[model samples]
Target: MDYALKESSTKFETILGTALKVPGVRVDREQFLLQTLGSKIKDGNIVNLAIETDPVTAGIPIDKLDKIANSLIKKRTTNTSMLSFAAGMPGGVTMAATIPADTLQFFGTAIKLAQELVYLYGYGEIGNANQLDEDIRRELTLYLGVMLGVEKSAAALRVLSTNISKQVVKRTSRRALSKTTLYPIVKKIGAIVGVKVTKASFAKNVSKAVPIVGGIVSGGTSYLSMKHMGHRLSETLSESIYYTDADYEKDFKEVCNEVVDVEFN
Candidate 1:
């Protein structure tokens, strides 16, 4: 069992590393969006913005997020030159590898969407890749899990929400979230997704045996999968209680208990 856990952990780390390395998708724009939205949240400008504009003052409207996510996914998948850039490489690299590359790009898109959605829903910056703060990383990980439709992530979010409502400092919130107890849940979520992505890649690769047909198949798969994941995340983040109020302690405690009761293995 210990060996299995270690193997799963290693596989998840490798996949995550590849996903993080996918280039072309921009992070600066998302970070800037977070900064702008953060300011709006601080100044209570959301109400005024909503009053002036449509009903979407706090965060980007779900419909708009959907459209943007679709557009980004399309751009990433439809660019044949970009998709095939690493396909023709010598020795050991083949069309099968492109699926993971595309999957990584999709994850990059998902991360950007997560950041934007989190900010829109009123959470502050959890730091970026360059930051070494474990607390911030842990917090971000919880959000990522939520975006990926992990049930435990929802419980963790509720707990974090409760903490924030009580005026918990970012550091303290991070500390609570970074508890050794929660590590397995986080790892489990990552491992599950890694396995899913790997399996999906293999299935997609079978369809992609022919290079020309493979590009189309891979692009379509990336497009549909990304759209599905992005929309799921947008819906979950958009309905956050943080958007309305911070009095979520009771709710958070309930969720924390439920999360604690969940046996990971």
Candidate 2:
């Protein structure tokens, strides 16, 4: 074992083992610390049993133990957050923005997870990209029904991030993921339907919502609501219908007729 590697691991074991020796935290003997921080291999061989950081030897000067002690004391003292020292302005806006976009991406995971499931089931059955969305929404609502009121933050974040990633995948180019095109589609749906529609919802419902309508509203709402919204919008505006088969021509014309002849009576 490399000298540095062995030394660091020993120090880490001492610190952590000491902490876990307290009641309520059982340390796994097999996994120990290496599982969290993968095995370190050097020169084509496993060099150390574990690796870690130790404050004692990290920046100590061997010649002057007294100076080294003072340096360690200063390092620890200066490392406290503003909130601990005396909260005032706190960290700057740039510090907040510096957080990775991938980290914040969890906010939309629910949509992403839905998309992945749709892709797994069969995107071809959903028709175009829009129809695929309905399928995703239909399935997602069913899944979320089980987790509606769960208060676990980590679980919620994972679900939401997966959902968002799935939504972004569709309408994204074959070569690259891009939400730019999908956002406009959402805006259009929001405008015609008089509700805030999102790419995630589109991905969710496109498969299950018939040719155009979907479960953007309540999970229990009849399919008629989605079809009606699509029917009205189709009549109000000139649109293009892209389908896997020319067979949909009849269905398209029927939808148009339904919109034109619509009556409350």
Model 2 gets an lDDT of 0.26
Q: Superposing every Cα of model 1 onto the true structure, what RMSD results? A: 6.8
Q: For residue 191, what is the lDDT in candidate 2?
A: 27
lDDT of 2 by residue, 189-221 (tens): 222221112332233344333422222222222
User: Per-residue error at 23 for model 2, in Å?
Assistant: 35
Model 1 vs. true fold: TM: 0.63
Candidate 2 structure, TM-score to reference = 0.18
* Residue-level lDDT tens digits of model 1 in 125-152: 4454554554544555565666567665
What lDDT does each candidate get? Answer: 0.51, 0.26
Residue 187 deviation, candidate 1, in Å?
A: 1.6
